[model samples]
Target: MNARLSGDEKRGGACGTDNAGLTTSTGPRPRRRPPVPEESHLLKNAAIALAAAGTLLLASCGSSTAPSGGGRSVVDAAPCARSTAPEAQGMPSTERIFGWIEDLVGIGYRRTGTLEGEKAAAYVKCQFESLGLQDVHYETAKSWNWSATRSRLKVNGEAVDSFPVAHTYVTLDQPSVFSTGPDGLTAEIVDVGAGVPLQSVQGKIVMFDLKFLMPPALLALQIEFLWDPGLTTLEPTLVIGNPFVTSYATAVERAMEGGAVGFIGVLSDYFDSNKYYNEFYRRTQVTIPGVWVTKKEGARIRQMMGGGNRSANLVMEGFRKEATGRAVVGFLPGKSKDTIMVQSHHDSVFYGAVEDGSGTAAVLAQAQYYASQPAESRQKTMMFATFDTHFSGYQVHREFVRKYVIDKETPYNIVANVTLEHIGKQGIKGADDQLEITDKPELRAIIENMGPTLKLGMINSVIRHDLRRTALISGHVLCPIGALPTDAGFICAAGVPTASLIAGPNYLYDAADTLDKVAKDDLVPVTKVFIDLIDAIDATPTALIGLPLKSPLYESGAQD
Candidate 1:
């Protein structure tokens, strides 16, 4: 899983470290660091440093009582403690919130619909209900369930060792065997390095070096490169620079269009490790049979193609039907009954202990904190949701929003939707060091005031989330939220306003994306930021236009 890149190879790059040690990839250079032990210590120290000011407040409040000699309790002289303010009392303690995250990671991965996933959902519901919020329940939806069984690659009909690329939509189907026909589609080997353009793919199985550098342009001739001609018929035909050049969907579309059946791609520097697997699993959709060969295999393929062979046979198999999963939901109605939605997905590809267990924990901790507060302290009703099937084309999210939040006759005035995902890992190399705020300026300012205590920086980048669906279909201000780039990209594509925040680095989709990756200290600040954001939103007097008005209490039970 480790690939060494020389200094020249790593120029203008970000360095990344993983369980496989360290490496570089395409895109941006990862911020490099020392060994894990040192890094962990530094993170722990950073947490301590951040909490130093807050700890002093607790120190000043502590006092000891003494007993009277006559068996009667006697009051001991002590400095007057700081008054417990409403904000302090309403917000859950940092330790309590982080403890919940720890508890969740212990539960392992909760893949949608499994006993674990359901159990995690139930835990979330109970936390919401315990907060004294009313009408908490679960919303079920039909969804497709998928999991990879096995993946392998072979060269010249011989098995070559390989690893499953993250987020790659894989098929259980037999591998497609493609070969150059006897008449031999021949051409000189052209290394159209990275960033291959479409026009250059005429009759060759375009071979590009997997180096981080962009490839040289192909020379035009009477060459027949391996390109699906059918793609040429489409408006804005598939461009070569798109990272999805190797996507199964693109491949199948081209194949059916009677384009070049022989397709090959050099694994990008991004594939130096498996850390992106989870994100990949969540985003990739497979439509064709494909395999990811090693660098060596790619080089060999280039050699054979250079000798002028154009035909290849490919075999593919493995198909399954779609099914259903559930998104557990519960509500705590506030005095006003206008809503504030809090959400997290309960599913994971592997034991997504940190990918989202940390997120789920944050929501639950917030729920518990909100529940402990007096009834009147909360201005808006809070909806606690654990979405299922987020990875399966967002089916559950689409259906749930349409049925509950969007199409209702008496629409709830929702101020915001706060979603938490992948908040456990430390910062990754080349990752943005800010919480992407997708709200209007007024709301963004309110959030900014609460940022420092949580160690959160700000990124005003336009991104998407599941909330986008609610906003688009219902015109609600849905704030799509999370901590990683790929997930943020996914959310942005869905068109929801996104707030991206990361507690850790790029352990994203790898096997290293485990409980160990989560930093206990990061949870406290994240929880604090979320709680404050909710309060700030609730404090707004004017509701967004087009929401339903409140009905009289006496008419509460009347059916519409």
Candidate 2:
């Protein structure tokens, strides 16, 4: 679904593809490049260009000698050769990394606790084992499975299309089901534009618009002042402009407190579509029943209730049962007990090709690369984990943290974490001001909470690989405590220094997130960035990973 800009001045031009196949503005010109077959990875010729310089060992290289741990050897030949940069070597190809994404996309609808979600977990496990990763197994966590069998909404005797807002429950007698009863619910409709300062909603169904906050380019300029990767050329649109909602969960709570029997949310900012999976899975409690409708449907309902008190009948039938969310875990133990975790989530509400299939593929690529190396060469043990339960409220993530990071009896000591998520194309304004996916890679950010040593590694890697429009922003700057932007956020909060690569494409939760949405061009480049980051963390003393008071890359007067 496309996004409609709200109350913000539009900059840049309508999105169009230039002769080079890169994103070009129809109104104003910037630059363009050739298509993939004609063009190559940005770093493709680094080895050739730097032939005069000494070659470095590429982690993706194959070794006949198996790893020290009870691990098998990876048989596939390496796709990339040695690089000029020492820590950044042996890059994986877009085909190799994206192949893993294609495998996950083939298993459709990987929502948490569903059969397809389990299939995705199985696939990740198989990939781990096939990549010669050790201790490849499933770690289970308590979770719930929910599905809406039937949902219907009628306003003033006219039936309107609707879908049950994800994770919302009804006052059912049985513990396993959430339904509006056999007769359904009928009540007067109350319009609360944005659900603030709730009034006159008691005993009625509250209808409100769900507002999303789009990060404007000006905000990106401010973030750059705090910390920029020193990019010679920057695309402000690609500077992490993902839209987010700060109040949908709070609005539900307010409506329930105001005695609203049920609620209806209008996806006002989203493109004309009701199949949105937004606000589907957060850790908040949702006792009051709610549903979502597109903006077009919402306008009609509002018009019907404009003058007199109109009635609405809502019916939603579904079952919420006990289920288990599992995380696929594999290991490569080094000489020391200190561990570095490479992770991403496996479950998603839709096809999730970019929402997480891309991240999961990165985990597999890193695991394959590291597994190909000898265990003796590793400075710290590596744990490759693709977590489940991201949609079911991150149960598996919290469980992993509790067991490994917090629990005293746990075997491994995780010192640092490298997480990958959402490597995809940027969204731009098109005809009719609708949001459209462009050929350019989505704005990417490395939300990191680390010391100068490792942070410098992050900057150098991003710049070295030419990962354009990327920032090394601090995690706390984006989200406060308990709300970091990445799944591995808990690790950072737990004092384990982390670098999480994430982008917020507007269609992240929509059905449009298909295989094509995956940022194919940046696949290898992203992996190379994290590989270099891990190596930098490994070289740093564990105590110094998160010890710096100020960023070395920060200019004295950079901030205004």
Candidate 2 regions off by >4 Å? 1-91, 170-175, 214-244, 279-283, 307-309, 432-435, 476-480, 548-560
Q: Find the candidate with the highest TM-score and give its number.
A: 2
Give the TM-score (vs. native) of candidate 2. Answer: 0.77
TM-score of the candidate numbered 1? Answer: 0.54
TM-score of each: 0.54, 0.77
Global local distance difference test of model 2: 0.66
Model 1 residue 341 CA deviation (Å) reads 1.0
lDDT of 2 by residue, 212-275 (tens): 7556453454253222345432554543335454458777778887888888999776666676
Q: In model 1, which regions exceed 4 Å deviation?
A: 1-109, 113-115, 129-133, 164-267, 274-285, 293-319, 409-411, 426-505, 544-560
- lDDT (Cα atoms) of all candidates against the true structure: 0.40, 0.66
Which 10 residues in a row give candidate 1 its minimum summed lDDT?
Answer: 12-21
How many residue pairs clash in model 1? 58
